[model samples]
Structure formats: C-alpha cells, structure tokens
Target: MTGSGTRRLGLSRVGAALARGWRAVSWYVKELVGENDYERYVTHLRRHHPETRPMSRREFERAKLDRMDTDPQARCC
Candidate 1:
C-alpha cells in the first residue's frame, strides 16, 4: 500500500524471475555439456533394469565413448 512497500514487492518479484531464469539457463548448459547424462542413465537403469547393477561414472563414460567410436551416427559432421 505504501511507496516503500510497493517498491520492495516489485524488487522481490524481479528477484524471483531472475532466479527462475538463472535456473533455466543452468539446466540448459548442463544438458548441453552432457553433465546430466550419467544421472539420466542411472535413472533409466533403475526403472527398466532394476536387477542390473548401474555402471560407475568411469565405466559409464568409457562405455559411452566406446559406443560412439563404433557408431558412425554419433560422430559430428
């Protein structure tokens, strides 16, 4: 209702919007860099192959690299 109160409310709203935008950008960057791939793979294994043991980070990265080496489609132009 007061001038200072209104200014504070506007600032809070702007802060919240900035925070959400920052989070979106962060997620995009993570995906772009393959940072979330391991987490996704682990989730998939848990969902579809619960009996199988999930690969460790090193093993998973090695396996991914091997597959890319063997698969031509994985190579960039």
Candidate 2:
C-alpha cells in the first residue's frame, strides 16, 4: 500500500511538470507557427495522446502577452 501510494505521488508530480512543459511549448508554438499550423498542432496533440495537453491558440497568445508584459526583454515584437 505504501509503495503504491508513493508511486501515485510520483506520477502526480510528473504530471504537473509535464503540464508546465506543455504550457511553454504551447506558448512557443503560438509565437512561431501560422494560424492554421498552430490549430493543426493543437488538434493533433489533443487527438493523439494522454501525456500531452491541448492548448488553444487564444490561450497561448494570452499567456504569451502576459509573460511579455512581465518580462521587459521578452517582448520580441
């Protein structure tokens, strides 16, 4: 029981980290990809796997704007 609980805890931490990484990737995609390709990528990730999380272009853009506002040098445009 203790071992299984520990495994579950570890999995939760991994899941949280993956979520954060996916957020960064989504932001990068928003900055780099064309609209159609960005939508396609989001849809592909949503359709394909349980490990990857789906993030909308809008969400990514909003997050990107937020980050840019927070970091003086992050705004490229």
Candidate 3:
C-alpha cells in the first residue's frame, strides 16, 4: 500500500476507537446520574406490568424526590 493510504487507514482506526470510547463514557455518565431511569422504568412496565401506565418524566422525578424527602437515609450525601 502507498504511504498515504496506510496513514488514512490508521487515522480511520483512531477515529473509530475514539467514537466507541465516547459512547462508553456517555453511557457511564448517564447511568451514574440516573438519566436513563425513566427509560428503564418504561421498559420494566412494558415487560412486567403491561396493564400499568408509566409515569411522565416530570411526575417520576417529583415522586422520586418525594420518596427521598420521606426517607432522608436514602440520600447519598
């Protein structure tokens, strides 16, 4: 292969690796911050409680905060 061709291939590999790394970091951050909790809750409802309706994001967050307020020990800090 030509020198420029090999360089292009190496650059492409680096770009792909960087993309995968970014996705991993994004997913980790979202999970750590409970950003995906509503999505997970919806999935759980569809699978295990098909008869129940899932809460809207606003309602879910409000309820979650209310629970935490009632049980201060559940707070991390």
How many residue pairs of model 3 clash at the backbone? 0
lDDT of 1 by residue, 1-77 (tens): 79999999999999999999999999999998788999999999999999999999999999988988899798574
What local distance difference test score does each model get?
A: 0.94, 0.77, 0.94
lDDT of 3 at 39: 95
Model 2 whole-model lDDT (C-alpha atoms): 0.77
**Lowest-sum lDDT 10-residue window in model 3:** 32-41
Clashing pairs in 3: none
Lowest lDDT 10-residue stretch of candidate 1: 68-77
Q: Per-residue lDDT tens digits of candidate 3, residues 1-77? A: 79999999999999999999999999999998889988999999999999998999999999989989999998887
For candidate 1, the C-alpha RMSD (Å) to the true structure equals 1.4
> In terms of lDDT, which candidate is stronger, 2 or 3?
3
The candidate that wins on TM-score is 3
